[model samples]
Target: MVNRTNRTQPLSGRGAGTREAIMTAAERLYAEHGLSNVSNRQIGEAAGQGNNTAVSYHFGSRATLVRTIMAKHGTHVGVIRMRYVKAAGDSTELRDWVRCLLRPVTEHHAALGVPSWHARFAVQVMTDPLMRTLVEDESLTRDSLCLTLQGLGRCLYDIVPPEIRPARAEMARHLITHTCAERERTMAEGLAEPGASWERTADALEDALVGLLAAPITRH
Candidate 1:
């Protein structure tokens, strides 16, 4: 699905710098505060723009800015997932496919170092009434993600009933995004567990997601 948001011409020089600064500031602010709670004027100010309309001038609306950030990070995560997908390679083991699903996002968070906000930012986007639709539109278009889903489906085709697959997949999504957000918040506040790390989180998520996807669906 093409992003229907308003597009700015490819920026150059200082214009590009300003746009990036605004996105960086917006991501951090939105991650810290709820999306609706943060204003474009505040985003511009945080970007160090003297012009209060900087966000509007550059990205137009909060939705467009959010899309831009999601697209940027989505591409990075797609790249990582593609590599993981290649490694999984026709493996029938459920855990291999589960790793393909969970590791890329956690690995990206690990690479972002401490004080990163994208995970938390994603939680807000995924949960927000207005922005939630954008997640499926943006994410479903990725080739790597498509392949991972296909592989996961093959693994679960016999075990998990078709009707409950969607619910389990949603559960997996919530588990990954919210847990990562919590970990990011913990680290940002200097309250992280001693030796706690994204790698460890990925390990745990892989185990939990495998169980989720492979569990039997009981009819009520």
Candidate 2:
């Protein structure tokens, strides 16, 4: 099993196009099937590379390959989120910071021009017991996320009880990530109900998160 304990830098760009093709193919395949089930040779064939060793050459191991794909989209998501975070100013509103946290994901998938794979790709990483923390730290941790978390936490401080904050934050992360993955899958399959859009999804999620975060905590 490929795990975070192995840290290998994929040889950069002997053939830039081939490397991207491999990453794209791997991301799509991994999103569809668990990464544990896919093989390097399968990813190589999907990338249109005839050599069975192509994935091993470009990316040292499956762990490195998964990191590469996460980094690919994460950079853009961070940049987009930073813009929203900066735009948010010092507002203490819960929904404002929630938007900062959530919109970048929806907008990123939307910008991918439909049938995007990254959301589902991300859900797999989030659910994986082995790779989850590694990818979360390496790819998903951004200055923008930190800033948004700081801002959001400030808004929640007066509302959420201290002991329950961490659990609530975890729940919020699950809701946003999984919900976006479901929406992306539905849209890709042409099964999204009428009137569904990324913006609307974000709005609904923001509403739910606002209430969840602001709700009173009861000690058992």
lDDT of 2 at 189: 92
The residue-level lDDT of candidate 1 at 61 comes to 79
> What is the C-alpha lDDT profile of model 1 across 79-164, one tens digit per residue?
99999999999988899888888888999998998889999999999998679897678799999999999999898888887888
Q: What's the TM for model 2?
A: 0.91
Please give the distance, in angstroms, between residue 50's alpha carbon in candidate 1 and its true position after superposition: 0.8
- Candidate 2's residue-wise lDDT over 46-71, tens digit each? 99999998888777788788888888
Checking candidate 1 for backbone clashes, the offending pairs are: none
CA lDDT, candidate 2, residue 49: 98
lDDT of each: 0.89, 0.86
TM-score of each: 0.95, 0.91
* Steric clashes per prediction: 0, 0
Q: What is the lDDT of candidate 1?
A: 0.89
